[model samples]
Target: MKKLKELFTQVKALNYTDGEDVSDLLWQLICYSPKMPVRLQSQQLLDEATSFTLEVDDSHFSHSVLKFNGFIWGNGKRKVLITHGWGSKAADFSDLITALRTIENLQIVAFDAPGNGSSEGELSNLLLFARATEVVIGTYGASDIMIGHSLGVMANIMAISETAIKPSLLINITPMVRLKENFTATMTFAEVPQAAQSKFFESFESLFKVPVSYFKLTDLYTEGAAVKHWLAYDPGDKVAPLEYLQEFLAMHPSVLSKEYAATGHERIIKDAGLINDIVELVKQGNKQGN
Candidate 1:
């Protein structure tokens, strides 16, 4: 307990850069220690505003569980499923959900991905993430528009390709084509020590607690085929490379792309005007469908 608290204090005191690689910090706190209480507290923090359940399914290669939080608007007829990025929880989409709630015809469903928040499973695999999404949408009666952020965008893309159920429209925020550039840049800019970098990956292996390979967005494009109107937003943020936006537009010419002037990756979700624009697009899509 003393060691855990000391570790937390050290992490909090570190003068971490804007894009500092905290994988080492996480490694010390989570993987190296058997601090169940600390892990539980972290999980609680991750799920602070999320209310959901664990619906487990064992039929798959490794047993997977879905963690879903739903908000019913009006008659609860129309539903939209929102997925968050790496290390994010269901509540991360609250701002978008609030904007969406203004439209009475829609309900919102959000979930924590495996190994991140209130979900079961210890690894973050694109295939498993996609499959979990399929299961959740199916369980929710297929009345949804899939909205995903970053990694979630790739997962949703894979989901559409793997599952029979399709969302009426797809909204991908700060989508990417590959993580090579972003990862390399982050590592270089953060100036993670060689020893720490090696330990960081080792920690990832231990912390994930499951077997799954990290996926490249190019892999999704190569193996995917889905036809749905796409609304993509990419700001000149450090987290997502500019090349990703360029490549995405090049590959999918039909995507409605918007580049925010000053907003970073996280701010895009909370931008009122941008959120309103997305809401309008969704409404337009619904009207066209009708």
Candidate 2:
């Protein structure tokens, strides 16, 4: 994978037309995929599972349907689906998967969204990820709880809003609030020129079939959700900083927001304490619902 910084250097040196070319290249590069060997921990979880594929609509591309990869663990009535973020595979949730298994009669499912891990395709976006998630939910019949990290949280939100799947419990860890804000921040960080940024938005809106302004974290909650919502973040997180959700959280007083001192973005997902807290919350909610 080419470094975004390196691409930024190249993008910075170009004229408008040339910069547009590089901008397109940079957009493709931003759609990250796994390159390293799957961790033994993640591999172990995969080994104990039955895998399946779901056909998803992809009208934007030539393919009639895309096969989304997913795994099922345990056979309990209680259903939980977990999703990982950009550049990460389902195996990144190995710790949480293992932790959740301890819950009696609990069925857990996790999948590699398109252009990610074992899933098909070379480039993917939020819309694709959400559609893939919607398919998994349909196959699972119903989800009692849904957990997501980083970009996965946004995908989950979009999936829930756009589909019939209404998980009873929603957990978002280090989620991005304003999609456009983050996109612009990323472009700025990459040193993408002003003209290139504008060109990229035009390209993005054309491809995604939704204006960037159409995406807002608040809209997910505003669309009417009776389900329990949990938002967690680490103050020190560099990736999806906690401050991003401040205004959104303020508007939605019902959301349960929690803070951790040193967990950061990546480690928080793998943190034993954090995972335990999440599982405990799920269990507690289960008891309350009963």
Candidate 3:
């Protein structure tokens, strides 16, 4: 890691001297996401799952054709789409998959984001994940139920807000608002060079052509999108503090939310009560015709 930081320093120097931008190197650093290892239990669940791979329509970018690796379970009336967050994969929802199976004739679809799980790609970002999500929703169904955690929540929001797809229910765990603070905090924790911070955003913006601020979940359009929204998270989550959703909750008074004690950031996705809350919400949504 120290060597990588040192290389970033050298790259920053070269970026300043020569006209060449460090966006490429900085791109690799920022988007270099590590994949989560599939647990034996998760693997056991996946063994029964029907896997799939769908190509994303990312022709507007120079990235090679990317595909999402996912699994489908059950063949019921309503469909559910599950997504995992940073460093986590679709199989992390093995418990939820089991719980959802109790529903008579329900379809559950989940996928790994590019560069995460079994999906192809060496690097990934919020946009890439969101685009992959759009492809999955396109192949599956537009009016399905969508569940996301952490960064996955932002990706789901981006996918729905930018497209005509209107999911019935949007379930979020550890929902966050802004990207600038989190991005800077991540760079700081990774010991990124102060000079290289701006360079990385330069690269990110250059590729997306839109500013990094566009990734903010709160700013994304949700009107006439998911008619029902529910959030389950711990207030003490440092990665996505309760305050992050304060503005959003206040703005959307009717948005349903429940706070947990100390499930940390990622562990809330596997919380039993959280899972029950999710299942219950879906049941209610079904009853009310969400």
* Model 2 stretches with alpha carbons more than 4 Å out: 1-20, 61-64, 223-226
Which segments of model 3 are wrong by more than 4 Å?
1-25, 57-62
Clashes of 2: 0
**Candidate 1 at residue 97, lDDT?**
68
lDDT of each: 0.60, 0.77, 0.77
Cα TM-score per model: 0.67, 0.90, 0.88
Prediction 1 global C-alpha lDDT:
0.60
Worst 10 residues of 1 by lDDT: 30-39
In candidate 2 the C-alpha lDDT for residue 125 amounts to: 71
Alpha-carbon runs more than 4 Å astray in model 1? 1-52, 56-75, 120-128, 189-214, 222-227
The lDDT, on a scale of 0 to 1, for candidate 3 is 0.77
TM for candidate 2 is 0.90
Give one digit per residue, the lDDT tens place, for model 1 in 200-252: 55654564553223445655653224345565565566677777677767776
Relative to the unseen true structure, what is the C-alpha lDDT of residue 86 in candidate 1, on a scale of 0 to 100?
64
Question: For candidate 1, what is the TM-score?
Answer: 0.67
User: What digit string (tens of lDDT, one per residue) describes model 3 on residues 1-290?
Assistant: 45446645654455344475655665655566677678999999898989998986544344578877999998877888887897679888888888988766578988899878888877777777888888887787774688988889888888886667777788888976777678777767656667778877776677679878777766684655677778887878888867868877877766778898898888887889888888887788777765
**For candidate 2, lDDT tens digit of each residue in 1-290?**
45545655765666666624575566754554544458887898899988888877666543557777889899988788888887777788888998888888788999988877887776677777788888887778767788888888888887777676677788888887777777787778767778777877887789777778677777655534537888888878777756767877888889888887798877788888788899899789778862
- Superpose all Cα atoms of candidate 3 onto the true structure and report the RMSD in Å to 1 decimal: 3.2
